[model samples]
Target chain A: MSPPNALDSARAFVVDDEEAVRESIALLLRSVGIASRCFADARTFMADYHPDDPGCLVLDVRMPRMSGLELQDELNRRGWTLPLIFITGHGDVSMAVEAMQAGAFDFLQKPFKDDDLIRRVQKALEHDRAQRQQRRGLTELQHRYDSLTPREREIAERLVAGESNKVVAIDLGLSERTIELHRAHVMEKMVARGLAQLVQMILQLRGSSRGDR
Target chain B: MSIPPLAPDENPLPAPPAESARTNFASEDRLSALLDAAVDPIVLIDSAGRILRFSRAAERLFGYGSDEVLGRNVKLLMPQAYAQDHDQYIHRYQQTGTPRIIGIGREVTAQRKDGSTFPIDLSVGEFRSGAEQGFVGILRDISERKRQEQELLRSTAELRLIFDNAPTAMSITDIRGHILDANHACQVLLGYQRDDLLQRRYTDLTVDEDRAALVADFLSLNAVDDSFSREVRFRTPDGGVLYALLYAGVVCDIEQRSLLMIVGLIDRSALFAATREADELRDRLVHAGRLGMLGEMVSGIAHEVNQPLTAIANYANAGRRLLQNGLTDAAELVSILDKIGSQADRAGQVIRSLRSLTRKREQLRERLDCNALIEDVSRLMELDLRANGLRLQLKLSPALPPVHGDAVQIQQVVLNLIRNAAEAMQERRGDEFVRVTSSARARAVVEICVSDSGPGLSAEVEDRLFEPFLTTKAEGMGLGLSICKSIVSAHGGELLYRRGERGGAEFVLRLPTATE
Candidate 1:
């Protein structure tokens, strides 16, 4: 097989104690040109999992030793951000709700249709991709934001808080031209094309940080 | 009996008829002493039945002094009825010169001085005292002996009553197996008359297969030892068979020698008929229980069978996708086909188990591995448990002793209980699992334990779980545990339950282990 590329490498790790079920899910994913790996149980999947893997997890909610819910909690404690798609049984509505509330991407009941499960897995993978891209973007923003001097950083915070350059000059007891110069430097260091762009980037950082919390 | 003669040779008088006057008088005094010393009361009466003489013994016996009764009429010593008849009899005897009771003894009731009457042995004799013809009487009280004789008669009558009316058949047979005497019940049991039974031998009443055993049992009792009990079929006169339990032993005589074999027969034909009827009813109940369980598990079973269908469809879909894309790895297509075939087989297996549960059939015993049976039921219940969010775990011991039982009935019991556990935990939230395990309890017993991780049972529920019409759930009819217990008990096993370690209900069934 050829080496995995950026898009091809994105996989769905299907973990279920039931062999036939897990294998059927993997095959379903493969039918849609999505690469997938199957694990007999949560423990084996945990041993093989990497935080940087570009994928989602299709996990059976209930298992003998370590259940999928428990594995989800463990992965969360280890700071892994892979989107989780759970496979629950018929009478497991409450468990599904709990899993979703715990930040799982979604859940599918057993004996679910092939397309149903495939669609859920696809959505979960898309969510995982979006999250990874956002994390990268946030890291780059943090690097640039950390490069600003204290005066420029203060002016940038005021501008993003809806204070114009003249208002920031009044609040900080500086000349309007000086405040404008500091705001220009802040915009250049933070890599924003305009005043609105700078404010929107800061808003995204706040939103992302709140999501982690 | 002969009466005592008054003028006999032992009168204590002088030997010679012509004795000296003084000696004759002395002889008379000695004769009086001898008469006074007699244990029997003696009295002399005239021809008119007048009292003439009374001895000291008579005074003590009559409760009167000799002086007080010297001239009293002899009628005073008899009851009113006898007193009236006595004087007439004595007058007739004197006139006719025909002695009545002169030398004969008879038992008569005499009145004492205090008016109490007692039975006595009475004898009277005639004697000539200086041309005065009179009578001497002697009497002995015999009340105690008479009362004892009456008691013996009453006891014999009571025995006859019991022997005639007892429900159980009974007979007395000689050591050689001859029927000596039989009660009415025995006649009814054998459908024959008492005379007919007496004419036949004990073995003649027994079935052909048991006749020899009957003779052997008779001879066995010849040792004059303990009684023996046996179940045998007796052949009645009309040729019908009578099932009976016989308790027989030797009846010894007063000399401590074996005289006869007394046999008691308990007729059990009615009980046999009733048991067969009950067995038929139980079989119907077992079928009904299976149907009920199927009703409860229908949706889950459908889902289980539907799984394989779903898998087969998915495999076909994937195979189609591959072929349309011109990526036909022929080997991959073949493998997918094989998987589809296996899935069909899996669904077929589920249907087969369902058919067994639904069919009405007779019970049969077979030697089976307990582990294999556990695995079979576990598979049957897997989809149902999955639907209810309950996990199924099987911990079957590999080398467990084989059990001889009806496979379908046993499977019904296991599946019913597991489903019951599912319903019990339906309301609870958490990791719910039903774990079934088989192990050896002892050399003679094997136990199957079904435990669940739901709310444990309360004492009242545990006590009533096996009772008909008892249920903790609104939809439950409560026949599951009752039928399970019946099936287990019919196999000589016990079904019991208790609170488990994981705060859930645990049911344990113990069946007698059979040797392979």
Candidate 2:
């Protein structure tokens, strides 16, 4: 049995120049109850691919016209976060290393055991699902934060920095009663259950924004 | 010179006293003395064919004494054949008054006293002592001159035999290249009869392209010892071309004057063909060896094979999973099994192609699409190029004419050039590319150019780029380009190199299109 959250709509995308290889990978994924699509080359896969799709890409590293690494670069440039699983053939260690450095989920040498490929694909799908959820959560949090009044946002930033309610009210040169009211509004808008939860959400937003570059 | 007056007993004919008185004894004695003193052996015969007077030199020449044959028939001095006809000839001459030997000198065979035969010059004169009309025949021994003439004739006959029977084709031509004489070999080699060949000028048989040079060589044969030899092409009457080594020399007289041009031709057509065939075989072997030695090619082939194997493995494992889980119907399982089978076949196909590529085989030529060849080579090199972080761009012209050449050999040449281009750009960073282009050139020629985006060749390396044993790579035998060049040339094509527009080395291979 697969994980409920990861496999509900998870699909495997197999891209290889070889028709048999591409078809067989799709077949293997299908046998494992995972839905799949096959593409004869990276360019075709890119043409039909959507950034919002919940899937893991099983890519052959040595396709003609456009190789797997090049496709990875294109995906990165478009700011798509689809997880990539590279299938390297013989003597493709250097390419595999390069793919890994470019944020690939994993790589498998050709003729690898079916279980190894299935396991990697499942893991890549789980990772992709988790990443999408995190991104959605961050977007929602930003929307909540965007809805805040400017004065309330300033008070929330200081409180999340571990300043006391009294200290935050002084730094803003406002009444403690005024700061307390603004904190309540901040927590309500961000949908935080408590002060600790509010602190974690704001920190996560700051870290993710820095990583966006 | 002294005269020994013949005693009465030794005289062949006794002079009558009345005739002797009419001619005086002093005059007779002086005439006898003059005849005896002559260096040439002479004998006097009468009209009856009997000997009348014998000089002393004649005695030493014929080995006879006058005392022994004072009245013997002159037939005794002739060979059997001449002796039998002498008497009749004399009688015929006397009756008809036809001067056979009279006032005419002839060479006739004479015999010595013992039995040896020798040649003589004979002349007869009619003399009258009284009422008798007698013929006085004078003869001279000419054996030494005759022996010299026979010697000259024998040597000339031997020289003629050697010249006519020599194995090499030979001809004697005037300075204008007009053939005066051609030997049997020359006639056979040219596919012409001896008389027909003799009627042709040496330039006529020469291939039209070579005729001017041959004429120039002939005109320069002014010195008595002038001679030259070179490889030339000759056209036969049947329109076949013959490769030959031609040697021309001037034949001179003893006075060192140029007389005739003696030309010799050794047919080298078969030898030239054999050499070309051997060169082709050698190139094929080297090509196979180079393919084997190419590390990048081996890795690429391995990757190609692995792709299929991986597919097969995936299918086999998938089939097992479906069967175990009962997750597929029989039809679906069968389809998966079929996929597995074809994948194995795919892997086997890759191996078979690799085996054929590296196998030492006879050079086989057929009409081939150059675009197809370039595409095949590009497929083979895909992984290698990717591994090096390089891109290959193919700009193949569609509807290209087919070129005639060995498929394997041509593929090898294309692969070598691509590999060389890849290596040249291997060290360069950023946007490295190797471009392969195929297009039809003028005159029914197909051109394939392999160029890279790396540094072009150095001047020193470019000078000897195609020379064997010249290598920039440490592991290279430096025979790749040379062998490729030979293979292209053997196919009646050309391989050229130049700096590409991208400022990298470019090799252009042009092969003639196959004519239907």
Candidate 3:
């Protein structure tokens, strides 16, 4: 694999009610070749941003208008799955424990190094990119399956079940000549070149069912 | 032969009876006279329904002369109600041939000629002469005998009633020591039933370990001629043992035989249980109070130590910076030592505070308004309340009279109550509050009420509440309330409990107000 690029190559959002702290964080991200949008609080971030892009969030733990935890909650409510990093001036161990437990990427105490901040931001961006790519791959597989005809679906089930052309045609009351044609269509549409490969694909799909729940 | 005139004591008295026969008749008459002269009342009535004779004894008993009643109806000596029936009774007996009352002795009522009735025993004998039949009835007055019998019956009944209903347990046993009877109180006190105790013997009621020793004591008592008495435990049916003061005695019946042993029982079960509870409570309270005092002292130590350490850190940081810049010298070292001395003074102040708190002393009483003392403690804890995000409501009644008590001791109680209230509400969210109220109870009484908005005391804790150091807190030593109870009781009053308005705990302290 090639080396990953800076966070600015992707997208980033900084949400804090303190304009000074917000601008300083934005500047810190820029100094490291990362680009970002800034919001004064959670409300402005909600109205302005699109979540589908691969990005990381920089948030302040305490804010007068919509705190960082509340913003995390609102983003979850809206199904905007961004990796969140929190910043606090007076960080207690329990509060830190709680924020980490809630899936926060990292927490940076005040007066932290600009280098340290950028390192975590880059890491969070990469995680976001990987998750988005996986979801895209799933969607492409879903689209391919949706294009199949009813007759093609029956052929595919039997193929996954390790049935031969002769047995499948006998079960469906079709001739072997027509069965061979549908068999080629099942492999090509499912992007599986062999019986082993097709079975592996079905197994992968079945194991990931819990992620839906 | 038809007309021979015999001379007196001549012609052999027609070959008459011998002289010895006449002598025998005279002796029989003398014996009859002796019977008549006896002190006991005697009367003879013939079967012909006639009073044949009555002795001087009978005269004293019936108040009548022998001639007056001789050959007269004996029924005349009876009451008017019995006289008319007497003749019919005699006539019916002579016809039935079954001899209704003849030859039988029985007790019945007799009436004197003066109209007084007394009990008597009458025995009858039957005589027959061809067709003439007769009954000889002998009468003995028995008024004294009846009185003696009644006295004996009353004593027996009264003793039985006492055994059955005595508030203290009691039992009776035979000479062999087996229980013959037990009272209801004995059943409740020993936790046994009448069936369980009967024939079981005194040794069985005692705990097995003590049975042999108790039997030996009883034997010793019999030998020395003293009653056997001791305090012992009798096992109960429900498996709880009871404490009792027991007493046993050797008693003899009319035949001079050891027929019964009287056992008296006085239960001390409640007193013993209460004493045990008191001891356990005192131990727990002391332990908990010591732990709590240790915790407070540690916190104070931390605060005191932290200030000096902070100063040391500042000094070190400053000295390092100065030395790095080449500005430190011997003069700067002198100032550092002075700073250390000042920090030592601050530490000293902390030790004194701890010393004052942990110092023990006999409580000294004074006159002061309990309401005012509570307010002072509350103000002292104001910062702690704010730090924990709690609010306070003071509803002290106006002009609360001064109470006689140890001010410092009562102050300690108030502080502990407030601190407990604060701790109970620590984990809960939303408007947490503690309210203190005071009221003028009566002319000589004052009540101080403390209530909190935390979860209330559980029912289990409430029951054994005043018993020393029982506590619901995980880290608590459980001594706070017990000490509070001690302090309140010392003031000649009571500490009462109730549920707070916000579904929590409420404690009220009632103290005797100081005289004006």
Winning candidate number (TM-score): 1
| Model 3: DockQ score | 0.01
* Model 2 residue B376 distance off true place after TM-score fit, in angstroms: 21
Q: lDDT tens digits, residues A1-213, model 1?
A: 223355546899988876777787777677777789999899999899888888999998888799989999998889898989988774677899999999999888766877787788778877888888888899899788889998888888888888877888898999999998888788888889999999888888778779779
lDDT of 2 by residue, B119-228 (tens): 87777667665543355556677788888889889888887788888888998987777888898888888888888877578778888899888878877888667898
Q: Candidate 3 lDDT, tens digit per residue, B1-516?
A: 000000111111121122322233335577468757777665544454555456778887888877677656677777666665676666566555555455666776788878888878776666443332345556777788989998889998998887688787788777677888889988777777799889987777778777787888677655213687877877777886778778888777558756577788877777788889788767645644654464464443553454454344434444454455555576875675566566666757765555455344335667897877877767666767988899878898888888887776777777778887888897877888888888988657888888899898888888987774366775454556766776677668788788887789898888899875
Q: Would you give the TM-score of chain B in model 1? A: 0.52
Error of 2 at B316 (Å): 23
Best by DockQ: 2
The docking category that best describes candidate 2 is acceptable
Interface RMSD of 1: 3.2
Name the weakest run of 10 consecutive residues (lDDT summed) in model 3 chain B.
B1-10
Candidate 2: where is the Cα deviation over 4 Å? Answer: A1-213, B1-26, B126-138, B254-258, B282-296, B301-516
CA displacement after TM-score superposition, residue B148 of candidate 2 (Å): 2.6
lDDT of model 1 at residue B164? Answer: 83
First chain TM-score for all predictions:
0.84, 0.91, 0.86
